[model samples]
Target: MRVLFTVYPNSLAHLYPVVPLAWALQSAGHEVRIAAHHSSAELITKTGLTPVLLGDPDQPPVRLTDDCAPPHHQDIVNRYADVMGLSPEGREHWIVFYQWLMQPTSDYVRLDRSEAEDLIEFARVWKPDLISWDATIPAAAVAAKVCGAAHTRLLIGHDMFGWSLDRLAENESALKAAGLDPNPLATLIRPLAAKYGYEVDDELLVGQWSIETMLEGLRLPTSTKKLPMRHVPYVDPEPFPKWLYERPEATRCECCGRKNRRRVALSLGESTRRFIKGDWDRAPKIIKALGELDDLEIVATLDKAQLADVEEIPPNVKVIDWVNLPHLLPTCSALIHHGGIGTYSSAVAHKVPQLVCDVEGVSLLMRLVEDGDVNKTGTYRLGWEFDEREEGAPDAATAHWELPAKKVESTVVSDFVISTGAGVRLDHRATTVEEIRDLVWSVATNPCYRHAAAALHDDWLAMPSPSDVIPDLEKLVVQHRR
Candidate 1:
């Protein structure tokens, strides 16, 4: 079979999930190549996969946008929430964060007619047997329908897209039962499908079948044909220098070979330093505070902007710009990071406890925040909560003064910390440096969180490997072929 893998091209986090499957299919004697926008060309090439670049790098990855997102994007989530009777906090979480995480498939953002036209042109020429896309890039569905290829959605994190679409259908059914006109999510979903002369259905977003790496018990509810694949932690294939593999105290006495007083991994994601124009760059402050933990060794990954602000590098803390997380995480007792799928998945694979500081930059939607001073521009739950004076809102039932405390701990917070049962969530706004120091020390010293993380890792390890699913995927291609 000839397979075409498609993605929105902005995030490697989204792209990596599909690579293992691609490799599995390729090794099984199928032809495989990745199709993405030009921005992702270098990364895809480095992975040693063939790439079909869809558009010029000069244009915005998604061609059309307004002051914020295109109107219909919000319409999809809004209609789903309204028909489902979701609470305001629920609505905001879906709209501002969860829905935004599905960026590649952001109908208005990723699917202008031009990108669709480009994809279909390639599909017509390539004549692939299957077209598998990352969860958000609905344009691939259009290309598949036009070119007569079978397709599937390869998921990166939670199936929030599938879960939301399922609720949309159920809610519409309930609305119909009550004699109210159904709020058709299809309104926002159908433009591209209709443009290609097909009506929308569950497969438009979720695909004919889908592949997910998250553990079964932790998945959001979905009605799609979902399959589990054991997550193989994706890392740089190039070998690391020998020094990184040695434990800090590997040279200690032979009797005990005493560990270096428990090592902790401290890494705030790229967004923490660059997002919000640097207002939430907590790396320096956090490192300085964690430095106070005299008995522990800290390995922190920080950016140049964050490195500039620190007056002293603590004896117990090591600050470098970057290290492969797969290499760093397993050596550590715990992780402190932005709640990205990459870090969370790595932590899960290594059975390391985490401290999710805040979730920003995962989504692109902005909301009218009534309590924060920004009111109109705070992009995600963590973006606005950094404001010290934000007041809790009764109408929304979100923390005003203490967002992590008041609101439902934001989408990414629950996804990374609470849902996984691996670590504590902090309202970073209310959590002081000393408090963070204490919390990090406790999570690192305590064994309960590690036990929970281990159980979750065990479940993940029990799932089928990518090669194990190749036969299933081949069978699906034969069944779903146009």
Candidate 2:
């Protein structure tokens, strides 16, 4: 069988999820090729997969300016909400996602028309029996359709695309009553579909089926048929630091003469460093707070850019620029992160309790407020200006979501983590340095968190491994392909 995978350009977040599955297919005697922007050819090859480059390697990848959407974008979203009788909260959700994530992604994917055209042309020539597309790049569905190949969405996190389609259907009546398009997202790709004498529909918008990696409990309700698979992280190889194997030395405790310290891994993740221009504003504060815990040795995977604002590194904390998470996770007692799926999954796999610093609040506007005084659009700025709100402002709700994941994605992960008793979520706005310090200490020393993490790991293991899913995928391809 010929299997082709399509991933969004630039970010490996979209690509890494597919690697283990591609390897599984290749090992099963199937030809697997990953289609991505020419800029991503090297990344694809690093995974030991054949590269199907989508554009000329000579030209620089497209760079979209970071700017607010026009005011009219909000007006249209508001109009849709008003027509649909959505609450202020629901309306704001639309505005926040439409402006920050949805619209920007649509624009980004559509900007490089040549990339999509190239992928479609390759699918035609290669004649792959199946296409597994990154959920973010729905254009791959069109390519699959044009080439008559069975397609499925490959997701590393929550099924936002499928969930959005479900949401659109629920709002169909309200939208039709308002004389608005029920599926604005579908409209975005209709032109591409039309170019090949096809119409944008559910199959083209979602896929024939989806290979879902999120643990079942954390998944949102969606109509798409899903093939559940375990999330096996595939990070770039890095030489292990010798010290990583050595146990952290016991530290003197004020009350107890000396105590063996537990090791905690602090990784805020790559999205903030590469795309957001800065780590979460409260990151330095969290590090310093964690550093104060004498019974915990913190190994922070923070780059110099993220540590630019820090005045001093605590003696208990060793900060490094990068380490493959899977390499460090096994030795750690607890993991503190910004809710990046890679970090979250690694912690789960290693049965390490996690401390996720997700910003809290249902309202996007409320979460972005700086000290409850001014609205700040960027998350990197939320904790930068002030750590606490004016004395009377309601304490920020438990940290729920952060960038990239948005509300739906972050909420699912946090809810699962908390429900499984595996870790705690700290509100970036409301948590003080002391609170963070105590939380990290509790997660590391507490046996209950470890037990819960073990249980969670058991659940993860129960899911089918990538290789285990080969037969099911083969059946799916046979059932769905033209």
Candidate 3:
């Protein structure tokens, strides 16, 4: 069977999980291709997949500014408020749900209309037996409907899309009464689906099935069929430094390196470093905080720009412009990152205690002020900014000691870590330098954390591999294309 995969054109992360699956299929002697805006064609080719360009390559990207949708869009905000009642828990969940769902939908709507049109037209020509698309690319469902192909939403993190689905399920009556379509994605993709004579529904926004990369228990319950996939990280294959395969003179890959010492990997995924047009600077302060611990070596994978403001580099801190996360993860005691899917997945895969930082994509976590001085629409500014408006889920977890996996993607991993007694939610805003010092100390010294991390590692190891899913997908195709 021939398979085609699509994603939101500009996202580098969206394609990672999809690539491995495509490789698995191709190795099984199936023809595979990647379809997206031509801008992504070269990236797809670099992955050793056939590139099927859908939209115009030269089209400028669409971005959302604070001004793009203003207070006048009270209908959007009020509608969300209506869906989530007056209860504080409802409001909190709404904040988490709304920011995540709306941000992407904002970008998706602005995608050149021709992007979707071109993809649909290509599907008519290619007639792929199966279409597995990034959940962010709503157009793929429309294409699948037009070409009579089976389709599924492929996920990178905990299914935020599923969270939206649950909100709909919880408030079905209110949503229906308001004449609101429960799925924001459906609302985004419906017009295009209608163009192809496909009636918009939940399935169109989601898919016939979903291929998820999260570990077992963390996956949200959803109406769509779920395929549990072990997130085998596929960084561009690289020759590692000799020290990676061979242990350093003073360090080991086990037990936080040297028997008496601990090494924390201080790193951020690419997006976090460039977050919100590179507005707020947090890396230097983070490095200095981690540096205060004497019993440690900090292996920070950072570029010169991230380190530009740093004058006094700690002797124990080693800074590299870049390094493969898989190589670095196995050698560290704990990881501090900006809650990116790839970093979190790598941390879990290796069973390293993780400290998810609130640098980006954490909206509701802001310190709310009594006088309505919430830090909304700001980019990664540190320090406590939220005040209790009306007590709901009182007492948030500490940022340095534990980071909540609050975002749609991080929640499952965060929950898993906390559930196993392995880690905690990090409140970046309120955490002081001393707190960060203590947090890493606890994560490194605590045997419970190590044991829990190991158990999670085993659970992840037990999941089906990229190659292992081929037979199941083959069966799925047989059923779908019948």
For 325-375, candidate 3 gives per-residue lDDT tens digits of 889878788887766778777888888988766523443433322232122
Off by over 4 Å in 2: 63-75, 78-97, 104-112, 251-259, 365-408
Regions more than 4 Å wrong, model 1: 63-83, 87-93, 96-113, 173-185, 249-259, 271-274, 279-281, 305-312, 358-365, 368-421
Q: Candidate 2: which pairs clash?
A: none
Each prediction's RMSD to truth: 6.8, 7.0, 8.0
What is the Cα-based lDDT of residue 385 in candidate 3?
17
The prediction achieving the highest lDDT against the true structure is 2
Residue-wise C-alpha lDDT for candidate 1, range 312-380, written one tens digit per residue: 789888887778888888778899876666777788889999887664323334333435543222233
Q: With candidate 1 superimposed using the best TM-score fit, by how many Å does residue 63's alpha carbon deviate from the native?
A: 7.1
Kindly list the per-residue Cα lDDT of model 2 for residues 1-482, writing each as its tens digit.
99998887666777887898999999989999998878788888888788888766775344322231222244576677676666664555455445444543463346345777888889888899999987656778888887889999887776656765676688899888888888877877787788888888888877888888888787766889889999998887767888878888866677877766788898876655653334546667887797788777888888876776678898888888888888888889999887778778989999999888777664543222224322222333222212222323332331212333233345446767998899999666778898888888888988999999999999999999999999999998899898
| TM-score of candidate 1 to 2 decimals | 0.80
Query: Of the candidates shown, which would achieve the greatest TM-score relative to the real structure?
Result: 2
lDDT of 2: 0.73
